[model samples]
Target chain A: MGKVINGLDIESLSSLLDEARKNKELVQKISKWYARVRWAGTGFTFNSYVRNHSFTISEPSELGGPDKGPNAVEYVISALGACYLTGFILNATKRGVNIKNLEIALEGEIDNILVFLGISNEGHPGYRKVIAKAYVEADCDEKTLKEIWEETVRTSPVGNTLARNVEIVPQLSLIK
Target chain B: MATVVNGIKLEDFNALHEELKRNAEFVSKIHKWNARIRWAGSGFNFTSYVRNHKFTISEPSDIGGADSGPSAHELILTALGACYSTGFIYNATKRNIQIKNFEVAIEGEIDDILVFFGLSDKGHPGYKKIVVKAYVEADADEKTIKEIWEAAVKGSPVGNTLQRGVEIVPQVSLVRK
Candidate 1:
């Protein structure tokens, strides 16, 4: 029913159209919920304000961010996991599945220094490779759960971000 | 205002012991706040550690926190925003919104120099005021997405901390333990 790559049935290219349409709508909704405020000072004193209810985003560490604060690249990984988990949960709930617990773990590798230096776009350390494992506690059959999980990823936000190429044109403002 | 330690005012460092008996939490909070001292030596060498509950500083100074540490106050904001962001993501994921990403950019105000000097002022060194903006991108319509975000923020751990003045108590652990 689909293109087979290394014995794995890959999604048809036609599916990308629906994915793009849904992504466009989702991006707009996410944008409206987003906001930021400056801490008003130098690099050491720079501050920003955000509400938890808005879109999930963090500024760069060079701009007075706590090293604990997720950098732009880290945020990308977080987004994929979050989107996948959320998608799974919604689908499970709709099916009246009695899920006691759900967890998603993701490990990704990227070239941190190369991208930072702007030397090679070829290996921009942007999740060069990612592996995700989902753990679910449910009463459904394995076959049914597997199908649902696959469907969820196909429609999840983070998965789409990784599968598609996005162009980001950020505008910078100087501190007054 | 000079907070009293035991029977003496906080200004009199020696008297702080006396005031410690009367109001322990207040005294403790002060002790935690002043855990680190900055001296003009080779450069800006920090001697303090702000943990989940207390302020800590070692005699040698180079412990968990070094020159790269976020000032004692920055930790407070970090904890608030990080806590809120983490909580919001957990909740949103459980709700099944296909939320792809979560980040918190927090800004705080500490315009007063008194905070730096450790004076007893109405504003806390922790954060006079803080603003946290969260961005959540999901695969849902605008209305549904907004509702999920609202629910996540209102119920997040960090959001709760910011809404209320979380208690800050200082404690120490034995290395031998």
Candidate 2:
């Protein structure tokens, strides 16, 4: 059995890296992700599905929802934290660092809710900033861990997506 | 009885909106959200906590995970769809349009997965583009419904978050064993 650190199979990860390095086609391929959501016939509540998994997305009681689950914005922040942690662990394992424990806490601040509520259009209704704090306990030096963290953030998919302006195409089909 | 449109309590939503308009402090104050993730001591699996709820996050089996749950990218797309759907319903309800059915489908294309795996840095590992399709059956006209959809897209929190750049501050605390 190969070395396992922080619940990651380093040997398997390394072999995948090697395979990608050898096959240029693999590196050139693009991966696609999808999700579907339907209104659950309630106040600001939705049922979201991705692959074989499903979950509830709803607002708090203050926002006219049953508070069944976390709001969509909260899910976004959670997804960001999860993506960053995954990247960090993978990078650390690849570097042969044994991580004892790891956790990432994230906070996202929306710029304006007034715009979303249609009360005003002074500013965009989106996250103005997102902050992430990573607490890592590992058998490695602080400097090395910081370097790995930087690399993880730099290469993180969700991190890059949020940090940059990407294209969003919206299509609408009305049923009369 | 209070007015209910598209399953939304119009009286309550309008009351909240009026209150916000009266109190600019509420509108001006930033709305902050939080989430925390902890490694599950397995292959790229995590337990994510948001508010009082918890769920699992994992990669596909092909990527060294047990495929117990959806990947982070998938979650992002789902979040976007949910946000857009909420925005749509909210707007439609406010306009007094009765929606019979509504759905939002989200698709995102990654620039390159190799960058995420640390195999290559040819391009960014983030999504290159995202496409959202909304299917709605409503009592409103086509043009009006289209306008509402556009407004919803523009006002969507997750949509705007994905459409524009946001500041990300990262910090690390090293815990010595």
Candidate 3:
């Protein structure tokens, strides 16, 4: 099996690597991201971009926002869940596993938004703890799928980043 | 100058903080978040919910996505910018300074997408470094505004979180349903 498995094709990926190696311009590639927030009537929304993709993030009416979209903290969790899921789909398929369905639920404990604004410095400003439950289903047995899961989490850029003393946040589950 | 500025009442905010302080039940605020992805015929799409707010997250046309929405990295940056900006408005207004125009440009450098998907374990998966530039035009002197900006970053939830570092890989479970 090449680098491409399931929906992920590793051949093209390798080709890119080959091109980079052949060119010798630089072996490492860095991704750039940009996010902009404009003033809204009562609140604001971010019109952000990454590699040409764009979207808006906002707060709900409860937070004095238009409730047009989700907040930054929420997006943090979204990034965690989404990043893991995407990695799994691409990687698992490469290993000859087909996912029937999958779901990952994430929960976290934060100090306080008030603390974040320096309103009160009593507690930590970031998340103190996080937990995730993953349910997975695939062509392989639970053990084998879990082996892949371990790899998924182990290899996940987001997962690994968060694991370095950030907080005790869990990330994974395959649909059974 | 009182804390109330830009129509946001600081007294109200103070009251909430005091209440939480007085009542331990309000302590250790636990925020719940959910994000689900479904195949959109050609690619995957996500609808994430938090604080009763919803939004779409997708890839651009380059990655075979419908280019329907922003990627996850973009959202993270958005959160940082918005949070910092909010802090600026609150602090500036509370100090009795009127803001003319404000802008915050945030940039981050990630190792590579291949590192993220585990194609190669040769690089760091998340952002190696992030740079932020804030442009502030206010009634007060530049020095004062800069001081306020410093306070904003110091007090910013997103800024602090990113700087302090946090967990990324959430624990997983196998859903039988």
C-alpha lDDT of all candidate models, in order: 0.37, 0.86, 0.58
> Poorest 10 consecutive residues of model 1 chain B by lDDT?
B56-65
DockQ for the candidates, in order: 0.01, 0.78, 0.27
Tens digit of lDDT per residue, candidate 1, span A61-137? 32222342343333333334444444454455445555544544444444232222222244332334555556666
Write one digit per residue (lDDT tens) for candidate 3, span B93-130: 55767666666667766655556544556866666666
What is candidate 1's TM-score against the reference? 0.38
Q: After superposition on all CA atoms, what RMSD does each candidate show versus the true structure?
A: 24.5, 1.8, 7.7
Report the lDDT tens digits of candidate 1 across residue range B1-177. 864321123244323323444554543232111111221121122222112111211111121112332332333344445444433443343344444444455555433322221222333222334566555545657666555555545443333323432222111111111
Q: How many steric clashes does model 2 contain?
A: 0
- Model 2 regions lying over 4 Å from their true place: A22-30, B28-30
Q: Once superposed on the true structure, which residue ranges of model 3 sit more than 4 Å away at CA? A: A1-30, A41-54, A61-64, A164-176, B1-4, B7-23, B30-44, B61-66, B167-169
Best by TM-score: 2
**B19 in model 2: Cα distance from truth in Å?**
2.0
Best by lDDT: 2
